[model samples]
Target: ISRQKRTHKIILPCFIGGRSVSRAKSIVNKDGCYFDFPNDAIRILDAMTRSSRDERIVIGKPVLRKIPVGTKIQLPYHIVERNLHSVSIPIIKSNFIAPRQSTPKGLRFPLAAKAVVRSVVHKRSSGAVILDIASRGQLNDTLRRFSHMFARKLEGVYVQPMAKPGTELILGYVHDALMGDVYIAGIGGSFTEDVHDIGFYVGKPDLRGAKAMLAQLRHTSIITSIDVPFVAHQIVRLSRLIHRHPEIIELDLNPFIAYRRGGIAVDARIVTMQT
Candidate 1:
């Protein structure tokens, strides 16, 4: 043992890989099961940290659920929007046209439409998402093109008014098999991935954590142009939203248009496990 290990009386963490424990009493000296391997490891680690002179919580809780054996299904835009109302994601109002229906009355012009395809990620450039329908003729033309392009895979159409311009931001979360849910905040828009300016965080979200994350961005001063606190609060809310909905394995709110008074999500994608 290293001198430091011996001095601190550290507990060696056990990972039950291939080795068999026929007795199978418990991993944590008769307190946990083999099915909960890594969790047991985490519990042990937390115990070891508590043994420190200054004790504190290591990882507060496990956010993501155990892996399920089923096909992955993405929640379509309409369902996502409906569910998001409860979470207060500041999503702009939108409508759907599955089973092929006419446009809802009273929707303003300069709208956008996206295809309800399960396998593909919709993007404006890919033609899965079409933007800027200035007139009814343009809307019809776009729908026909969308119909022709998607054909059998097409489920329906998602239509929403074009959102107003605002400073763009991104709120994203990933359910990591090992680390659990990892949330991210970053500069957003069409090139969010390309720019690669982001901050990653672990643990439950709060205003403090959200503010700290936004502060890490390259352009920290950009907060002056928008309601920085609201943006930060949105990040916190999005994290909690995912925490509440374990079915959501991955989610992205890119180009969350942020204006002085508030912000709105122009585009969103949620990946989930089929129940």
Candidate 2:
């Protein structure tokens, strides 16, 4: 394709061998100006092939194959004000508190209580699965069993109050063959297959791109029209979460509940895949 005809909005001083050479735009005209573009432009080219651009070239960063993993952090898009212990307590008291009035925190629920744990990511029956409490008795019985099975003291266990299900959003990053570092945004977990909401973008992630991608989703209503607080704000927050974490290989929030304008993740899991 003629460099002038290429509408990626990125321009390059045409290169000859290893040396950069300036090409006269008039010479290329409508005729194809075929030259090898840096490997970093592959994704841009692919996107263009799928859809033509009106701009010139898009300067893109080179991709590195072996990405090194560094510090890890779980950016809780939801549950900003509360902790795990807070949410789990109510669930324990209501479901398992058999001793009557209330159940002790560490000792577990009463005789008829159930044991509940919240997962960071949505995997129906995985190691990080969270259980529901029914009675105090069940809570106590299950606690011992869980401790024995895991062979570790359940110190981090927190009693929680059950909340209604909201929306699910997938946010993360992956190596892009063309655009170097790329961010991934999708909808997943129990309803991932059903929702089928996902989008990808090159270059540094920003609020503009994030909102644009969310608008493309079929269920954007959950974030725009939902009767929750911080609906749109959370989406922007999610974009910021991903933008801040460049080391994250993949981050999954099964159900990102849209609470007013801000949403909370009922469950979440993040995997760091660095070179």
Best by lDDT: 1
RMSD of every prediction: 16.6, 20.7
Model 2 Cα lDDT, one tens digit per residue, 1-275: 43333553433322223211224422332232222223213433444455443322111111111211332223221122122222221112222221112335444322221222322233344343345555656555555554554443222233445445555565545546567756555575566767677776676556677566566666666555442323334444544544544444554444554544445555444443322
Query: Cα deviation in Å at residue 224, candidate 1?
Result: 2.7
What overall lDDT, based on C-alpha atoms, would model 2 receive against the true structure?
0.40
How much is 50 displaced in model 2, in angstroms? 45
- For model 1, residues 1-275, the per-residue Cα lDDT tens digits are 23323464433333232224323423232322222233434544454444434332111112111223343545435446655665788898766554345555666899988776656753655778888889878877877887888787676667789988888888888888899878888888876867788988887778998888877888766677778799888888887777777667888888688888888998787876523
Given candidate 2, what's the lDDT at residue 86? 27
The CA-based lDDT of model 1 is what? 0.66
TM-score of 1: 0.69
- The clash count for each model shown is 0, 52
Which residue pairs show backbone clashes in model 1? none
